[model samples]
Target chain A: MTGRDRKLTRFLRIAAFSIGMIFVLLGVLRGEHLEVFAKAVRICLECIGIG
Target chain B: MSGMHRDRVETKDRPGLHERFRLLIQLASAALVNGYAAGFAGCKIFTGTSKMVCLPVLNCYSCPGALGACPIGSLQAVEGGAKHNISFYVLGTLMLFGVLFGRLICGFLCPFGLVQDLLGRIPARKLHVPEKIDKPLRYLKYVILAVLVILLPMLAVNQFGIAPPYFCKYICPAGTLEGGIPHLLMNESLRKTAGALWNWKLGILILVILGSVFVPRFFCRYLCPLGAFYSLFNRFSLFRMDLDKSKCVDCKSCENVCPMAVKVTEHINSPECIRCGKCKAVCPVDAISSRFETDMLTRNVAVKKVD
Candidate 1:
């Protein structure tokens, strides 16, 4: 690959990583993790074919 | 040495130490994530604090021994909740994993993927799916992701304003194998309640089991939404496959061993590649290699020539 292509690829990777981290922080602020936790702690009867 | 002679030599050494190391990692990952032995014995799912975190793979949250939430399940739960909101937490977690490792998780970390890998070891005649059908069928997982995982959970709601996790309730063979069958085996009352839905899930599980026995990584190739999600980041993920065009002799050894049917010579970083290192292990000239993108930036670029 050319030097220009390499630079572009690197830029894209860094941009994606930053975006992912930002979303994670936003999700934490919104307390979505707590929703996930509350749901996961249960037996999830539908998941086990009971529902 | 000629390419043909090198090919024969490498074929004899196929699935060398790389594969063995990968298997060790796969086993360790499967064990570490499902470490709650007490949950299994007591016939209960883990309700520990660790359940708050989402695992990167397709493990069922309802599995008695699971310590963390499955990303897809958590996404569906939040999406189908009374609020019917999208789950930023699960989506962000999945994106983080995807950007970091891509489908490398499918190759090494997923408990369900491990099951399919083990099943592929059975001594049977492997069936080769024709390109005419296989190419299109590979899109089925993405459809399932968009529909069962994202669409149905968001749009289809009951009178109470809650929606069922369509993927888990209707399609997830992993849930049936790891959570449903085990729970049914442990609780007699649960077994008594088994209806057509449970039977349907059981049938899907059997089909997946049988499919894996004949075709390697059948679920990952054609049915795993998690794999499809991870694949989106494969091209830009930190983990990457690099092929040295200068050293390659067009031997096609890597293509033959690839379980995902990735055209490694043409597209070394194809999204379909699971990065199982089978191609790397079988390469006669050590033309195929893997590295993190950070490593590429820091290393002496002049010493490496990759395409």
Candidate 2:
């Protein structure tokens, strides 16, 4: 609520924004590479009597 | 007297199988990954599928016909090369979700987290780490990121004296167990050629999985680089805790319900807080709410009558 607190919150928000961008970038770049992961998921499902 | 007890039993029973449904979702998600592997007879890429979701959990990436890659594995892949450039697309996608969901992924989305939860169900008395020990030890994941994820690959020399994914090779329990184990298990070629390095990775994965059952999310709290990344978004994340001190009775109910041991009052936006909504669920005064960024903070006001 005060100036100092607002500054700190703003700093935290900016920091979070930067970090979030990093994760989103990584996820999109590699989204297509997960064919192997998806395949593994299918096999696991079959083992558990789930289609 | 017995009538009151009967009513309590009726209310506590959940009326049906909500718990069962959650268990089914957890199991089904885990199963799908393993099932994909079984169908392909080995790990193979799916060329036909266009839509892929980066599952919000650690899944065995080596399983065959995997429609999409594990985020951790993909991150390593991007950094494994000499160029050392991160895939902005992947980073953006993960950031979008992290800002929105925070660590709710750990409680509600992660397959591995679910596994740990299920394993903790065993009647063995849980060992608790005192706050003194638990608080500082949570930084281990950041260490893993800086050392295992960033430094190692950046430093390693390759065929032409370049670099490789050191995190994947040395520290990532997720990559070792997820992408490495299942493929190695089913693929005769990989099993025969497996070396001491493989043993080392297996040892680490076992330690991580077993450790998580003892301490809530030991991996997520400590060694999960991905979790470390999401944690950074905890405060400003679209989904996050909002505390109205006006009505907070300060009874510590939310603290008791939190699995990650976050003090709901002392620090509402700790990087370690996963924004799981569990605290909101158990708040007796309904003072804690995970209101989204856009919603006019539609806070649930406590409407109790007082004399």
Candidate 3:
């Protein structure tokens, strides 16, 4: 691959990583982590095929 | 045996140090995620602060010993909630894992993937899926991700404004093996409620077990939504495989030993590649190499500009 192509790929990877971090921050701000915790702590009946 | 088949058998007979190290990593990851042994005795799941986080792998949150939530399940839960919200946390966590390692999680950290790999070692005759069929079947996981994990949970709600985690409820054999069976075995009340859905999941679990024995990574290749999601970032993930064309002898040993059946020589960074390093391990000439993209970037920065 050319240097230009490598640079573009690197840029994209950095962008993706940045976007992911931003989303994680937003999710935390939205209290989605607590929602996840609430759902996970319970016995998910559907997960065990009871629901 | 055919040449490729013979090479595969030889590789199996003499696993390299890399293989042993990978096995150790897989075991450690499995143990770390499912470390609550006391939960199993009490027939209950972990309900600690750890559940606030999502695991990068396909481990079931409902598994008695699981300390963290499964990303896919968490996604579905948020999507299927009464408010119909999307789970940014799960999505971001998955994206981070995909960008960093891609499906290397599948090859090394996923408990279900480890199970399949172990079953594939049963010494029974393995089945080779024809390229025509295998190629089409590979797309099935993407469809499952789209429909069961995403669409159904978002769209199909009940009278109470809640939709089910379609994949975990109806399909995921991992859920059956990790959560369903163990819960039923320990909790008589749960067993009393077991019905057709439980039976269906058990059947799927059986099929997955049999399929894994006959064909390595059967679920990963055609069913795992998590693997499908991670595969999207494989081409540009920080972790990468580089094949030095000058040193390669076209021996096809790497291809033969690849559990994912990736066309390594033609496309070293194919999305299907799990970054397992089997290809690198089996390359007779040391032509194949693995590195993080950051390493290459650092080297390029140090070198004089030639371009």
Q: For each candidate in the order shown, give its overall lDDT on alpha carbons.
A: 0.88, 0.60, 0.88
Q: Residues B73-145, candidate 3, lDDT per residue (tens digit)? A: 9999988988646778789889998999988899889999999989998999888999999999999999999
Once model 3 is optimally superposed onto the true structure by TM-score, how far is the C-alpha of residue B281 displaced, in angstroms? 0.8
- Model 1 in CAPRI terms: which quality? medium
lDDT of 1: 0.88
Q: What DockQ does each listed candidate score?
A: 0.67, 0.18, 0.63
Write candidate 2's Cα lDDT for B30-145 as tens digits.
66654554435635434334314454555544445344556665455555544445545445566766766777666666677776667666666566778788877888788877
The alpha-carbon RMSD over the true interface for every model, in angstroms, is 1.8, 9.1, 3.0
- In terms of lDDT, the poorest run of 10 residues in model 3 chain B is B298-307
Order of quality (DockQ)? 1, 3, 2
Q: Which stretches of candidate 3 lie over 4 Å from their true place?
A: B1-14, B295-307
lDDT of 1 by residue, B1-307 (tens): 9999887876666777777798899999988999889989998989988998989989998888999999999999988988637887788888889988988999999999999999999999989899999999999999999999999899899887789999999889999998998899999999999999998888889999999999999999999999999999888788889999999999999999899999999988898999999998888788998987664345335537575
Candidate 3, position A19, lDDT: 83
Docking class of 3: medium
Where is the poorest 10-residue window by lDDT in model 2 chain B?
B298-307
Residue-level lDDT of model 3, residues A1-51, one tens digit each, is 567767766776887788899888988898888888999999898998887
